[model samples]
Target: MLVGIPLDQSNNTVKPKECASEMSAYIVEVAETRCKRSFAKVFNYFAPRLRSYALKQMGNEALAMELVQDTMSNVWQKAHLFNAEKGSPSTWIFTIARNIRFDMLRKLQNRKEDVCSDDLWPILCEQTADANEASLDQQVTLEQIGYMFESLPVKQKAVIEAIYIDGKSQQEVADELTIPLGTVKSRTRLALQRLKGMLHDND
Candidate 1:
């Protein structure tokens, strides 16, 4: 959902200046303008995922709910502190979740409720940093691929759109276009080659 439409890093757009990561653009918007609509989008998307993550770590529905609420509160409060150069939005958000989990567990331990620090599994900040790097790279690459689709020749674009975007099989595309399957395959292959060359040149 976050990947398809690249925006222009404004209230009305998604593309950021340095990177076209959608979440990052959203975060930056929240930071600069305190836009509740953007914050709500962030909340709606990440809340359930954070609840699942917190439930896995804490093994309690109540704690999971708490984590989701607290983590999102921190996200809104600290959105201005987000540095997109360091890690993706995922890592930043999860790091907040991890810290909240730690604090929750630590408090439980203080009450002597059988929780122990030794049993805790904290998400390593560095590890998540690397993971988010790969994630950010993948997002940018996908955006570039979207750009590539705009440059395809008309016939090739039709074929590629039918197969990939419209989720039609090659045979289906062949029948729809009244062309043989072999011709469909050839057009697909040539369109892919052009996209490959574009990728290489961009690199």
Candidate 2:
């Protein structure tokens, strides 16, 4: 009962109850050689469904569209990995979509946790100190820390600020900075290391 848009020999689109195996075979063709028509057929059939699925999960039209685009791009790239014997084409594509959605959700959760994290400023005051002394120590320590942070390399400083101060996930920072996630992580790590060295030298 699966209704699909199938292209006939005349290049006419027809609604047919196509078997999943046939669709999978077409994907195999796409894998072996780049076939624009075959891919178009697959895109026509699956893109809207993937979009709807993403919309329901993400609840944002723009993000859902992005999800669909990313999922389809993955499909095109990984077409060779699709095995009909292991799973149907629909199952494989939906699995990719599911994984993408899960990753997005995980990143969103990370951003939320980062927003609430206390790691932005180290606890520098002794608990044994009086309240007034602790307050003054904290103020001085925070000022020094801020100065050190500002001294970091521009890219490193930007990464740390986005992640820790702005509560943005690494992915968000990457997108904002037009850099890769690995770059964001590397800059943050290097920034922290340099900041630690500066603090140690001062002490």
Candidate 3:
């Protein structure tokens, strides 16, 4: 029988449990005995990558950083429940982040649909913007979009067109771009970032 010493700063005693209790007990002990160091080590290992993932998902740097911090905080609070038999710490942490993001997105009820209809409207239609100014603004918007398109890296431009203009599914864009699905996802995300910047600049 192996006698495990408590190492964590917060809980310097063994936790009683049946199967795989030793590993759980070890983590709990380490955390209780060395709470600061344990949390620091875990944060260092996961924060940067998790922050980048959150930024890609949220499209906002400050919010992304908040999400990452929230994730790490949860990991610290829930560390006692971690089971090596189920998954590694990295996997467990990422799963928590993913769930948090999903919950956040679900709660955001103000989502706007991005798809546009390309069908031409009849000229004998309801009056919208003033004809002359609307025509000028439309021309300016097109010119601005064209300039922004030219500024994008080729891969980013292609992904934007496939999704916004050609109406491709993300999977289809991944296949056509010959990039891994995750790469495709990230590139598309950054492409939207660029577009937002460009549009804001024009405005």
Clashes of each: 2, 0, 14
Superior candidate under lDDT, 2 versus 3: 2
Superposition TM-score, candidate 3 onto the true structure: 0.40
- Say which candidate scores most in TM-score: 2
RMSD of 1: 22.4
lDDT of each structure?
0.78, 0.75, 0.66
* Per-residue accuracy of model 3 over 1-203 as CA lDDT, tens digit each: 31343333332232323313443444465456745554554565467779889999999988799889878777777676566677555566667787677656655655553321111321122345444643332234687788888899998888888989999998998887678889888988998898887777665
Worst lDDT 10-window in candidate 3: 115-124
Residue-level lDDT tens digits of model 1 in 150-170? 999999999999999999999
Q: Can you list the residue pairs that collide in candidate 2?
A: none
Candidate ranking under TM-score, highest first, comes to 2, 1, 3
True-structure lDDT of candidate 3: 0.66
Residue 119 CA error for candidate 3 (Å)? 41
- Report the lDDT tens digits of candidate 2 across residue range 21-56: 667877898899977667776777788888899999
